[model samples]
Target: MTAVSTEIPQRRELVTELPGPRSRELAERRSAAVAAGVGSVMPVYVARAGGGIVEDVDGNRLIDLGSGIAVTSVGSAAPRVVEGVRQQVGESTHTCFMVTPYEGYVDVCEKLAEVTPGDHAKKSALFNSGAEAVENAVKIARYATGRQAVVAVDHAYHGRTNLTMALTAKAMPYKKGFGPFASDVYRVPTSYPFRDPEGMTGEQAAQRAILAADKAIGADQIAAVIIEPIQGEGGFIVPAPGFLSALAAWCKDNGIVFIADEVQSGFCRTGAWFASDHEDVVPDLVTTAKGIAGGLPLAAVTGRAELMDAVHGGGLGGTYGGNPVACAAALGAIETMEAEDLAGRAREIETIIGDRLRELQATNPAIGDVRGRGAMMAVEVVKPGTKEPDAELTAAAAKRCHEQGVIALTCGTYGNVLRLLPPLVISDDLLREGLDVLADALSPKG
Candidate 1:
């Protein structure tokens, strides 16, 4: 068992409105100094957080249903994580892993090897964000296989970096004006069952994509096919059974590396430890970040030793890739997950949230589709029977929930999907309360 030292910290109380006077003052200051491109989910400025709740500077308490965009899987301000960060900050902060190796960084990598999927000899390299991990994954795949081309799926969100933007599908916000991007990144159809051609199964969609990749990029020239098992931003679309497995098999047969961008789906966001496990498919390389360190800025690319080692010495690294604080936090987060059985909790949330949303779909025709694995669930909002997306309604519902004290987020290529990412540690009572709030927000007014 990974040892963890946890000391619960004191929780703060909220006394004012969400963006209380102080927070409003700060937001005004931020508007002038911060970049205009940067956006915030909520106007509330966070003062303190513990367990599953966040206290705003205005003294308003909120149930963190989004987990800071799925980063705080273990919980916000988890005792073990906080304590680890506290201890590590005093010892040292940054000594670039590439320049001066650190034990915490190495230890985190060792932990990643043991926990990240496959039993085969594995290696891991850390990065600062999910985008860096993905960009490096492409580098490793291309270097190892000597291929120039890469394939990604539609509605997939890899990251914001140049190479990642080329891999990402949406253009308006992410890719617009950010080109000319890295060369040889290609896109294919995604296995979106709800929107798939009438009778096509998930496997059929995968096959079609494979055929498209073969024709457009040629299997021999493709270095890797990176995808999210469950598309996070593209409406939480979970591909049908056999889709991932079939694709993995095809990649193996063609000597193409299959990379799973599990930045959002791994670490028990799904019912299983990794979303890929749901299909019994082992990817050649897995890139993860969001929840790996329970809110710390840490990410990793874990892969087969051979593929990772192919990169020459001094090829993969960053100045802040594995800051000791982040590494310590990761060790603490992993320990918290194991001891608390957070993976099992994720499954439990899926059953509860999925059932509740299914019931909502039956009554609310606006809910065109409800799909996802484990706690990463979402409902597609539409205009009754047709697929005419109701992005406006989605925004209205989200605003209603926020006003009613439950923080929720909307996603999708069309921006019509409402995603729920409550902390795995949230109590059953609190979960029910948050869901009730959501129902009220989406309920038809008489």
Candidate 2:
């Protein structure tokens, strides 16, 4: 197969209505064949995606601000990723990493250790999704520390699997009806600056959470304290300054493994290799996915060698855990990140998008908060005069943006956050245009 063009025009152009006839037909077919549980942010069917635009089957090109929920950070069909996938497909797709390993898998693991935070000697185990990585990280923590209790924080989102559902805090879509979740999982308060009492410092908030965990689940019994340094689905919540470090310190002092779920915040998404680097905090185990393979199915748990090796041989191996093709794609993705300095690009995105969103907040009282790091940013919508979440307004704004040839996503526990995860490779012009579309969507008339 030929490589996808990286030169696809970097502008949004509507050739037809959103979800035009072709997309409508595809939607009908999808409804019939696909499971009802599967959800989509938009009904438009993508025909080609590259750079900052997702071209639908109806020939309408929409500026992508979601980046497939923070995947494709190097842009959909990044040239290097395409090349790597193509080469790997021609050679071998799978040999079962457990049965017969390839150099690609090891190479990806080595890259993970190098990119993830901390200077300690690290080892890695590959998986197929963020949820799998998280589950494995928890398993490693339990095995290494010989503790059964796990602590997840409020407004957290880990994944949808049984164990992850127990860890995830939200219930509506992610956890509802998913019953009999894994045992010994506990929830604690997190340092949510926006919702926390005014003037409460990060240290205080951290102490509050620590006390809750200690009181509820004794420190000796806790295997791990997992968190998203910047919560993803719970809103692009960047915890108060000292929150993460304090938590890491507490975990260290108490023999609880600190696992940072960087699935959405790692790989230069937060202008760094990992969000933990922002505070100079080091996690004992870090779960990474989303941007890891540049749109391929790949995930990993990278951590201290001693902890990782605690799992005996044959304890952690899946049929397709480290598929050779996906591993190759990850190698290419890492190469692109390094060659293009995408971390620096993410910082640039922060400066550009952050300034614009703050300006919008100044004029729009409904925008209760503007927070996030680097390319991962969001605006929490609320009532005009109060902090009451406005999920209706958030949904309406998202609908308007979708209709106007811009892809925007809504998140947050209350469903009131308009998140923007634009591809780091997006051009300055496209970024501003997408933001303009968002502003228009949130306008009074809209």
Q: Which pairs clash in the backbone of model 1?
A: 14-59, 15-59, 20-58
Query: Which digits, one per residue and each the tens of the lDDT, describe model 1 over residues 133-181?
Result: 9999999999999998999999999999999999988887889998999
Q: Local error of candidate 2 at 68, Å?
A: 0.6
lDDT at 170 for candidate 2? 93
lDDT of each: 0.87, 0.93
Deviation in angstroms for 386 in model 1? 1.1
* Whole-model alpha-carbon lDDT for candidate 1: 0.87
Q: What does candidate 2's lDDT look like per residue over 1-446, in tens digits?
A: 11124867777999887789999999999989999999998999999999889999999999999999999999899988999999999999898988888999999989988888888999999999999999999999999999999999999999999999999999999989879899999999998899999999889999999999999989999999999999999999999999999999999999999999999999999999999999999999999999999999999999999999999998886999989999988998899989888999999999998999899899999999999999999999999999999999999999999999999999999999999998888888888999998998998887
- The Cα RMSD in angstroms, rounded to one decimal, for candidate 1 relative to the true structure is 2.6
Best by TM-score: 2
Pairs that clash in candidate 2: none
